[model samples]
Target: MSMSEAHERRLRRATRILDIPGMIVGKAAAWLIVPMVGALVYEVIARFVFNSPTMWAYDATFMLYGALFMLGAAYTLGLDSHVRADFLFNILSPRWQGIIDGAFTLFLFFPAMYFFTVATFEYAATSWQQGERIPTSPMMPIIYPLKSVMPLTGALLFIQGISELLKSYYSIASNRRFRDEDGHP
Candidate 1:
């Protein structure tokens, strides 16, 4: 194979490998809806039919929803499903698109996610140290577990970003958009 062809194969391999974590984590996070829905349904039945209320249901639903949203971010990114103002972007040539995407990933996405991961790690550390609990609810569910998801989500996004950056570089070198395994650009 030519050098360029070999490099493209390497890039594609890297993309596939990096995509695995987001796929697994994202699918797992999607299942959070089950427990969240269960909590809501139980709350409704308890509050209305039985003429009683549960304190933990609200907290459970809130935390589950938050986890689902945060954890799904990297998964959505892997699918290239994030919304962007792509009117002007779509009109650009593939080389220019790669330039912009790679530049943004290098200069913007990396720095922002780095700070986000650091800050969230510290946030979760403090929460764990204090054994934090939700003060708003009577049951006072432990919040440190939920807080831990923040840093984890950041790390997931960072990993997925590496995949995207590789694709962007491939696009730059080939003067064509790099397609994922599913044939998506």
Candidate 2:
């Protein structure tokens, strides 16, 4: 293979490797919606039909929703599905786009995610250490498990961010927009 083709293959391999964790976690997290819906429906039926309410449902729904939202971020980012003000961006050349994205990822995205991971890591550790519980309901479900998802989500995003950085590198090197593994731009 030519040097360029070989380099492209390496980049593609790295991206695929980095993408796996996010894809797995994101897909698993998506299943949270099923249980969340079940909890809500159960709560509604219990409260209305039987004049009884559930304490666990409120906590369950919120925790599940939060986990789903956070966990799906890396996958969304991998798919290049995140919201952005891309009106002018869409019109830019691949090299310029790569430069802009690389700069942002290097300067803005990296720092933000780094700090987020650190903070959430500490938060989760403390929660776990304390055996924290959600005080909002008498059921008082242990919240450390839920809190742990924050750092995990951050780590997942950070991993996907590396994949993005690799794509940016490919774009900069090739002077073309990087296509995904499936050949989508």
Candidate 3:
């Protein structure tokens, strides 16, 4: 293989390997929907039929919904399903697309993610240390664990970002669409 081809292969391998964790985490997070739906349903029944609203249901649903939304970010990114202006993007040649994507990932995306990850880590850590609970609710579920999801989501996104960076580099270097292990373009 040519040197460029070899480099592309190595990068593709790395991206595929890194994608595994994001896939697992993202798929696992789907299960959160079950509990979220259950909480809402139970709350509806309890408030209307039994005339007694749960203190924890509102808080639980909020946390569950937030967790589901945050936790699925990396997974959505890994699938390349996040919202983008693809109408303009799709018209470019693969090489030009790669160039733009790699530049954006390096100069903009990575820096933002790094800062976000660090900030969230500190936020979660402080919450954990203080044994923080949701202040708005009388039930006041301990919120540190919920706060902890921020860093986890950030880290997962960071990991998938690296994989995306690698794919972008490979596409640029090879002047071709980067395919996965299954050879889908």
Candidate 4:
């Protein structure tokens, strides 16, 4: 196989593996919403009817909300659900848009996320070292693994972004949706 063919296969394989994580993240994200809403309801009921609030509810809600937001990001990006400046591009021909997508991802998306992932990893590492937890609610200890999700999501997003970048490049190069040579089209 030619180098491009080999590289394309590699990208597809990686994307397939990455998609498994994306699926898990998506499902986890969906489940988080249930607890987020439930926590709020429980907190309200506790304060009103029982005249006391659960200590951990506040912390749990906060953490759940954070996890929900962070974990859902990559899944959203993978679905192309993100909003962007597509006004001019919408007017352009599809091929031109593909070219622009490739160029923009090369110049902006990858570089920006490279730094974001690195910095988030450092921040999460510090939190882990300190054994950080929610200060306001002690019962809900800061789980270092939880904080680590920030960097993990960032990395996932970076990977998905690269996949989209690859899609854009392939669209321009082959004048088709990014797909294998087997006419998976």
Choose the strongest candidate by lDDT.
1
Candidate 4 backbone overlaps, count: 1
* lDDT over C-alpha atoms for residue 145 of model 2: 87
- Per residue, candidate 1 scores C-alpha lDDT tens digits across 1-185 of 12376877778888999999998999999999999999999999999999899978989999999999999999999988898877888798777888999999999999999999999999999999999998877898899999999999999999999999988887787778786546575
Model 2 accuracy (lDDT, Cα): 0.89
* lDDT of candidates 1 onward, in order: 0.90, 0.89, 0.84, 0.76
Query: Candidate 1, TM-score vs. the true structure?
Result: 0.92
Segments of candidate 4 deviating more than 4 angstroms: 1-18, 136-140, 176-185
Residue clash pairs of candidate 4: 133-142
Q: What is the lDDT of residue 9 in candidate 3?
A: 66
Q: After superposition, how far is residue 153 of candidate 1 from its true place, in Å?
A: 0.8
Worst 10-residue lDDT window, candidate 3: 1-10
For model 3, what is the C-alpha lDDT against the true structure?
Answer: 0.84
lDDT of 2 at 106: 94
Give one clash count per candidate, in the order shown.
0, 0, 0, 1
* Local accuracy of candidate 2 as per-residue lDDT tens digits, 107-174: 99999999999999999999999999987779999999888999998899999999999888878878
How far in Å is the alpha carbon of 179 misplaced in model 2? 2.7
Q: TM-score for all predictions?
A: 0.92, 0.92, 0.91, 0.79
Candidate number with the higher lDDT (1 or 3): 1
Q: Model 1 shows how many backbone clashes?
A: 0
- lDDT tens digits, residues 1-185, model 3? 12365766677688888888888888898899999899999999999999999999989888988888888888888777888898998788777887898898889988888999899999999999999988899987899988899989889888998988877776676667775535463
